[model samples]
Target chain A: SAVISQKPSRDICQRGTSLTIQCQVDSQVTMMFWYRQQPGQSLTLIATANQGSEATYESGFVIDKFPISRPNLTFSTLTVSNMSPEDSSIYLCSVAGTSRVSNEQFFGPGTRLTVL
Target chain B: QQQVKQSPQSLIVQKGGISIINCAYENTAFDYFPWYQQFPGKGPALLIAIRPDVSEKKEGRFTISFNKSAKQFSLHIMDSQPGDSATYFCAASTGLGANNLFFGTGTRLTVIP
Candidate 1:
């Protein structure tokens, strides 16, 4: 299992402002992912943060709105730019376990952003 | 298109009873299915998972039943307790190239005493 941590456990930001969430893992990981959980909703994959190259984003998401940076194997950051009421959600970072036998993904505590 | 579909957005079960949540996937390429449990103010944690090669896998009181032909799976919690109450999510992944996962909406479970 991988131990994951996130910064800014909870933040209240003004509309139109941007917030950058950080994720760090205890061990080197091959893949890091960013996810969003809206109020009363399930987890939505935001993007896959690649170590050396650009992140792979899912549909309905883009790099312009949610920029991701992965400088190394153990660290990555996701920025929610030009925030709005719709952007107020819990952002989480996750890492798949290193063991090839297990595909389990461990998640961080999550950064809860409230846009006012 | 939603790759995974879950049923019973919310469930209420009595203590000592069984709580079951079901999910179905549209993609035949999905080879790995996992269920996650999430509590308020917390990120999801993997509860149990099953590969298409297996029909079922059990861990303690939690069991995952997978039907490859039906493209469906379900989570069964035996002897439900109040502490078991939380939101559960079903997700699928191809486990190939990138291994990006597609998650379902979620099921809120309440175990009443």
Candidate 2:
């Protein structure tokens, strides 16, 4: 298993403001993904951060609203642009194939965002 | 369309009892099914997973039973404890690493002493 950490554990931002959440893994990883968990809801995949390439945004999500950057292995960032009250949710980062205990993805602590 | 479906939004099980959560999928292409546990203020943690080729997989007190023909699976938590109280989610993906996973609504399990 790998140790993953996210910056700004919790934050409150006003509408129209943007916040970039950073995810850093203790070791190099091949694939990194961003997910969102709405209040009292299950997680939803936001995008896949690819190294040296444009992130793959999932259906119902666009790059204009959520932009991702993966400069290299072990690190990635997701910026929630034009934040709105509906954007308030827990943003999580997960990595795959990094000492996977049982071929499962390891997740970060997640950044709790509250858009006011 | 909802790729995966989970049952029993909430459950209450007594200590030392069996806790079962069921999940069904609509896509047969999904070969990987993983169960995640989430605390109140934390990210979902991968608990256990099973592949379609296997009928069951067990690790410690957690077990995953898969029925490929029926397109269904379930998680069985034995010897439940209060510490097991958390939101559990069932997710499925066709591929690993870079593939996106479809998640269920989640089940809140409360193990009472």
Worst 10 residues of 2 chain A by lDDT: A97-106
Across the candidates, what are chain A's individual TM-scores?
0.96, 0.96
Residue range B1-112, candidate 1, lDDT tens digits: 7789998899999999999999999899898898999999998988988899999999999999999899999999999999999999999998654377789999999999
Position A33, candidate 2: lDDT: 95
lDDT, candidate 1, equals: 0.91
Candidate maximizing DockQ: 1
In terms of docking quality, model 2 is medium
Off by more than 4 A, model 2 = A100-103, B96-98
Fraction of native A-B contacts kept, per candidate: 0.63, 0.63
* Clashing pairs counted in every model: 0, 0
What's the TM-score of each model vs. the native? 0.96, 0.97
Residue lDDT tens for model 1, A12-91: 99999999999999999888999998999878899999989999999999999999999999999999999999999999
For each candidate, what is the lDDT? Answer: 0.91, 0.92
> Looking at model 2 chain B, which ten-residue stretch has the lowest summed lDDT?
B93-102
Candidate 1 ranges with C-alpha deviation above 4 Å: none
